[model samples]
Target: MRAFLLLLFVFLTLGAAPARAQQPTPTRVIEALYDQLSAYQLRRYQPDSGYQLLTLPSTFSGPELAALRLRERQLVRVDLVYSAYRFDPKFSQRQLNIDRLRNLDERLPGLLMDPSITWNLIEQTGCTTPDECQQYFHGFVLYIEKRYTKADTKAEIGRLTARLNATEKKIERIRAVRKSPGKPLACGYPHVEDKLRKLTKRIKKAYDCTQKDRRPRTVTFQAEVSRQGKVLNVRLPAVDSAGAAAPPCPEELTGAIAEGLAFTDGFLLGKQRLPFTVTGRLSLPLRPQQGFKVTGYYLADSLMRKYRVKLLRDGCQARQLRPGDATEEDPIPNPDPNVVTRVLERHPDWQKQTVVADVTGSMYPYTADLLIWLQLAAAGPEKTFVFFNDGDDLPDKQKRLGQTGGLYDARTNDYGRIRQRVIEAMGAGGGGDAPENDCEALLRAHQLAPEAQDIILVADNHTFPRDTKLLEGTRLPVKIILCGVTDHINPKYLALARRYGYSLHTLDTDLTNLSELPDNQITIIEGVRYQTTPGGFRRVSGRAE
Candidate 1:
């Protein structure tokens, strides 16, 4: 039993030893290092290599193991030192420290050491994602060395320079692929160049065929390009291009070409082709038209009936009523002075008379009363009444023209009161000092009272050079009766009256009684009569007499 027990124990011990020896020691060490490195990578501060040294397998022995442990320790030291330096490489004394670290192999005393051993340890760490690991490792080293290094520090630079260059080359390759011609086929499409060529040929053919004669014409057509770069349907909207106002070939051709060029094989596999319609306009030079130059005119009889004046070959002539014979009371058979004098002699009682008044500034109250008299005259007398001076109704200078000086007369009629007001207004100088422009005032009054038959200006004739157009159209006879102070009348005012066919009557200072003037002259139109037949006959006729 003792021998069996001893043998069993030996067998068990030997079996276990072989199994342990066959185990993946290197893999376990590497995994343990990876875990430690991962922890260091994730930390805010770099970890010391002394702690990583514990991960080595106990079976690892002698110089090889020592060298491996030493190399790992140096790597860990490098990581921590790089991390610390990278944090703030600008710190003073950092340059001296980095130079000392870089010369580690030379500075170390008698221990077989290589500065590159630390770098090789990092590279051999078996990173599953090596690129990312290398980036972090190289970036930490570069960042640490940058502050102390000059611009020419290429030797001290990290592996990041090479990695960055490799990344840039990869990007260039991708861009080249994107720009490559016919690469659209990678997305399953036909070459755009091929479709464009076919479309150009078809368009040229259609254009030539549709516009055979070259006469101006319009055409309209519908077309569709298939996803396979084929022209599917091309037809005119009309039966042919002949009936079209403009040709459709150009637009149809353009649309077909565009659709073809835009076609892709990707569209061909799906539903890419779409129907498109086009229209075209063609123009040709046109000849000018030669037509009649029609004109219009006023017919002879039509113009004769419409206008009182007649159009002669040279100019217009007035239509006149011819007198059959002369009679005794035929006043002024002609407008001629001799005819007028002869008519006046035939009717001895016939007389041309005028009544005038002033109505400027303070004379307005007197003028209102005078208007009543004038209205009466207008209603009864056959003669005309004339007024002078700016009335109260004149624009821009309108004002009351009379005052009684705090006196009143209840028994006075309108005319009586007016006469009194006139006397008072005249005593006040009647606006003689009120910037009176006699010529402009008369011309303005003539325009305002255009319906009046005769004018009897009573101003002091203070201003001259009146506008003459106011009297140019007066057909009814006019008269001027000067009132108020003498020496106020000028030849210009008299000439204005004569210009408008008026007879002047001067009521020079001595006229105290107003009734001395003819009643017919003071009153308005009362009656008028004319014989229908000319003969030596007895007749008496009257209207509104």
Candidate 2:
């Protein structure tokens, strides 16, 4: 009686089944060779010759696996099977798949590195893992693609080299621009400096006797003034030196000081129309006889000046501020609440996850949100992140779908390093076009962390993926966390989700059934009507309320 036949290694050893004529001994070389073969299969392709598959009898082992070398051909898939007569007979499909996956995983690295191969072995089916995939009786399959000619390959390498060089130069240029401290604004008018001094004096007087605590207190305010001398915006620091929230000043005092600063004239300026910011810190007196002390720095024409305060018995007086060493002009903005944290918190199962985030200019808030999550979350070695900034400032015309290469990777528990990576990617490039190389970034991220079970993609809902066509090549389950979405979901994301069966996570809800929705079926999300299509979802009405 013949037993059930399954692919690769199996436990099906029941009654008698015809075994292959010869049984070969298993060796580590064969395992390593299989690993190498799998490595080839995981590579990205440029539409070369297609992949091929080969199956061998479980009994047909030994050096045969290691001896495989096609002259110009690539081995994309390889399977090892167990002879039915020798192994245990009653093996379920689940166990069989699990065994096969284990075998494949045992040799994953060789497959990931080999450029000659091209097929995502782990994601060969709709399911990414063996546990979730349905197993069927099938022979081994190898997929391959033809490579470029010798001359073409050389030329392609040269082109890529030049592109890489150009991208590096672009990044350097961005760094230089950000690091430059411009020439100081030449404010020739002496009276303008006098007005700034008097303004601080009035601010100190307003804050006098305001605090309930008798001890010394420091009140700080940052204000931006246009070149024309008009006070633009005034804000108190959210937090002080000790990490405590800055105590709020009386509204009346704040209003009075703002008005006083606005009325002061003679803000001399240059040809460039940039705002000069003032950061003032007023230290209240420690003793009854002592006066309030006010000292701070202001940037005028890219030059920094430190105001000197002299304490008097009655009240401190302000005088000319000496020119101080230049520093970054603007204070860092406070981090705004974002949806990335909210979405991730709701899904606690996203463990050992690889995060791929867009670090473009508009997505800075979301990027900060990710950092906040990392800082506050439990510490561990499991977190891995990839930050991509749409090609390192590459010009729109020069960027290709899969090659738009501004991707930075970090795998560590240190939140600071992850933050630095985000800043480097952001400073290098902040996407030129409205559409970003989202799929390209994701694919690279997958390569960076193939073993990661959950891939969390933090994307911009407003920007569609420039490389949406490449989505099919990725072999992981991607949970897209969309930021900056307002009334309606971007139809492009919906389309990708629909075709690929991805779940879309927004600030409030998750659309997991997009892929399973029947064609032309209507559904409502957040008061928005959408109809499912074969390709993706289409909005049937206007923006959602």
Candidate 3:
């Protein structure tokens, strides 16, 4: 009795044990597949409903079963967990694995019969583990090796020859299209009715040429047609023969073709027709070497020159010129003696405007002139001056205003303490090779004066990644004036200006002497002239209009 009870207790304990601890229900494989499918859907034009996931055991097709087996090998842990729990509560873990393995073995042979479906199955399932994937990969390698060996037999020889013949036929078709004379005939056939007729005729000619054994020849011709629709001159420039066996066509053939085209009213009666040229080519498969060419001519016709122009009377009415016209004067009125005097006489509210200076590299001379003009204007504490730089390093030590030198001498100096302060604010500490993060600099500037309106960036428009980031993030209305930069302004800067509703000024030529630029709205000022030689400075005098 005691032995019987012990044996029964042992059997019950074995049956009640949990199914291999459930293995954390590995969901990573399914999640990864879902993510990949989502990414593919982003680029797909068709609806997602077209794709369907195949279930295992009964519903899976031969190719799908083979692919699953291959995936199972590569994604070993994930596949094992999936196989163990695919049917869940209906079947035990051991039963599920056995059923999947049996079904996979049975379906693989049928899957191998169709290579395209096999390829599709393998491609769709991006197996995560290596061992499981290598099983299917090894099978593919063996199959390919066998296929190549079979193809080498005498019976398969004709199949390979047939493929080559098909390829040759395709090449012949392409050559026919390339050498066709339709392109020349279709040129400038603007009217719908005329275009359709020309296109139809060209297609018929191309078909006829392809049917003949003689290869097509190509000829280029330049000609001039008079207003009365007569050929004035026609000459051949180049001739490409259809084939080596074919003789070159005479140049007279091209001339004849051009004469025919000229009388067809294709030439526009321009004041003088720019030397227009066309190529005439005969498309043939056998005689590709035969072709002709033609060259230049003049057209005599009633030519009408098309010119567009517009005139604006006032600066406010100027349609073409914007706020940042480079040739025009500064948009903000300069605080120079002459400009301030005119402003006082006209509106008497001349003192409210503010002045900002970009004391960056190569801008010292302009900044000095600006300061001098501001002093001359004398706005009696109403005028404000702001300074900034491309760099963002703080100064080592702050200098006393008058301790270093007299205020007059210090103020007159171009690149002195004031310039140093601007450089310090730019955070110029990471050596000379440090990248200038313009986005950070712009953000810092805004933080300093958030209330300021109409910020002007007076620097060369040499942009970087930081500039793009700044433009994308900020909504500030900032206009850019390219001072000394002549070429290669970064496109990102232009895009940023457009996005932020700002204007761009490209200043390459001289701006100090012009009284009035083509743009009437902007105000121009005469700054100091720049020279390469040492101690070479000249003053330019010009009145603003």
RMSD each, Å: 61.1, 19.3, 36.4
Per-residue lDDT of candidate 3, residues 1-545 (tens digit): 34334433432443333312222212332222222110110111111121122234334567755664442221101111121112234545333333433444344422211111211111213334555534332111111101112223222334323433454465445445433212121112111222433533433343343343344444344555544445567555543343343224434344444434544443332222233233334333323233221222222222111111111222111112223332211123333323222323343432223334444432433443443333333334332334543232322122121121101111222323433343343222211111123344444445555665644444433222223334565686454554433322333343344445555545432222221222112232232221111111111121111
Give one digit per residue, the lDDT tens place, for model 2 in 98-120. Answer: 34544443433233223223222
Best by TM-score: 2
Residue 371 of model 2, lDDT score: 72
Candidate 3: worst-modelled 10 consecutive residues by lDDT: 36-45
Q: Give the alpha-carbon lDDT of every model.
A: 0.31, 0.54, 0.32
Q: Against the hidden reference, what TM-scores do the models get?
A: 0.19, 0.39, 0.23
Supply the TM-score for candidate 1: 0.19
Order of the predicted models by TM-score, top scorer first: 2, 3, 1
lDDT of 3 at 396: 12
| Residue runs of model 2 more than 4 Å from their true location after superposition | 1-336, 542-545
Model 3 collision count: 37
